[model samples]
Every structure is written in C-alpha cells, then in structure tokens.
Target: NATAKAELGRATWKLLHTMASRYPVIPTQDERAAMKQWIFLLSRLYPCGECAEHFQQMLKEHPPQTSSRAALSDWSCSVHNIVNARLGKKEFDCRTLSDVYKCGC
Candidate 1:
C-alpha cells in the first residue's frame, strides 16, 4: 500500500506538470483524470463549470512549471485546503474537470 501510494505520488508529480497551468486553468483529459481524482479523494474540493471552462481555455494555451513528486503532494494538500476555504464543503463530479465536456468542438 505504501508503495502504491508512492507510485501514485509520482504519477501525481508527472500529472502536475502535465495537468494544470500555474496561473490557474482547467486541464486536459489525462490531467483531469489524475488531478480531479485527487480532488475527489480529498475531503474537500469541488468543481465549478464556469471556472472549469475558463481555465480549460487557459490551459489550452499556456502551460505550467514542471512539478516534482514531493511538490505535487504538497500542492495537492494545499489545494484541498484552498478549495475548502473558498467553496466550503460540497460534492463535485469528476465529469466537470476534463475535456470530455460536449462543447461540440
């Protein structure tokens, strides 16, 4: 279990680089599947459609810094706190964070 968690931490590190942009943005499908899964796993964190759409556009253009495994773990933990602080407790769907939205694009 510890090893799996460590591998997941590594995956999250790879994901942080590939997932979200630094200036705030939505993410690609691969990114969303990983990062959003982290969100859902956290006791806090929810999705917002309007914010998600806006950020997606941002991510489509600008990318973020490459992340380390330790950095991502810290970042993910902070995201949980930040989301909880901003949005309060509520359920969000995994569907909202990815590029799978039917934009007809």
Candidate 2:
C-alpha cells in the first residue's frame, strides 16, 4: 500500500510539473481562473485522502499562482519542497524546474 501510494504521488507530481511546464507564458484571465480551479479540484480529488487534506490546507495557505508559467511552476516546486521537508526528503532546486520538467510540447 505504501509503495502504491508513493508511486501515485510520483505520477501525480510528474503530471503537475509537466502541466506547469507547458502552461501559457501569457495566459488569459479565463485561463488563469481555469488553472486555479483545476488545482482546487485536484486537491479535492486526489486519490489519497490524507494527502488530499494536506494539499487542501496548503492551498488555503499558499493558493495557486497562475499569473504565468514560471509563477505556477515555481509555486508548485515550493509546495513540493514543503512536502519533501515534511517527509525528510531533500528539496528540489526550483531554479532548474524548466530543465527537469521538459514536456517536449
């Protein structure tokens, strides 16, 4: 079960980061709103209940930063780092996100 959860988490993070990497450089207002709404829905619908609750709280505190692709990617990295810290894992270098999460799009 733990292995499954970990795999799910990794897949989810990959999806999130890839989406952020491919986000519009200058998204329209409606696009930004949609991105934020999608994030909220993700928090609500994540497979792991405990992880979903934690993500919801993080959203309450940090909210989604959808101003630009970079902002959303950086916000996601920061939030991922927060979870890493909680898990006693090493934090990722946020500056290298573009290099790390190339969506090839």
Candidate 3:
C-alpha cells in the first residue's frame, strides 16, 4: 500500500511539474497583465475546439517561457488535472496547488 501510494505521488508530482514549467515569471505588473492571453492559452490546453485552436495559434506566435518558475505551477496544475483523471484520485487541494506552484505565483 505504501509503495503504491508513493508511486502515485511521484507520478502525480511529475505530471504537475511538467505542466507548470510551461509558464513565465513576469516580474512586473505590465508583464503580468500582458499574460492574460497566455493565461487563457494555458487554461484551454486540451479539448481542441476554438479555444484550443486559438491557444495553439498564440503559442506559435509567442512560445511559452519553457523554464519559468512562474509557469511551473500552471503547467503542474494542468498535468495534475490529467493525472487525476487517469488515477481516479481526487484533485489536489487548492493549498497544495498553491504551494507546488509557489515559484510560478
């Protein structure tokens, strides 16, 4: 039981980490405000409809930070969401998400 739980945790962490890494650090208010478009892109990573289509266009126009701490949390959150779907685990707590994505925030 402990081993299974540990593997699950590791897998979950990896997924969230990968996703979060897609964001940027935007150190200024202007930079932060400018991210509205990208933030929207992140929120609709899947379910390839107009939202996804639009997001893809934006990504091509301006690729993500790729290694930003600020982005890690967001990417991680998305990955976490997918992992939950696969594992049938409940979503991580908001506090947990906040902490995992501290660098991104």
Query: How high is the CA lDDT of each candidate model?
Result: 0.41, 0.95, 0.52
Ranked candidates (lDDT, high to low): 2, 3, 1
Clashing pairs in 3: 16-76, 19-75, 19-76, 20-71, 20-72, 20-75, 20-76, 21-72, 23-71, 70-104
| Two-way TM-score contest, 1 vs 3, winner | 3
Candidate whose TM-score is highest? 2
CA RMSD per model (angstroms): 15.4, 0.7, 9.9
State the lDDT of candidate 1 residue by residue for 2-103, as single tens digits: 676446544543454333323125345566456545544431321344435433443344322224333343444344344445547553343333332222
| Ranking of all predicted structures according to TM-score, beginning with the best and ending with the worst | 2, 3, 1
Error of 2 at 46 (Å): 0.5
The window of 10 residues in a row where model 3 has the poorest summed lDDT is 18-27
**Please, what are the lDDT tens digits per residue for candidate 3 over residues 1-105?**
667655756754565464454444534555544554555555475443543564455555555443445554554455445547656988765446645533343
In candidate 1, the residue pairs with backbone N, CA or C atoms under 3 Å apart (3 or more residues apart, or in different chains) clash, namely 26-55
Score every model by TM-score.
Answer: 0.28, 0.97, 0.35
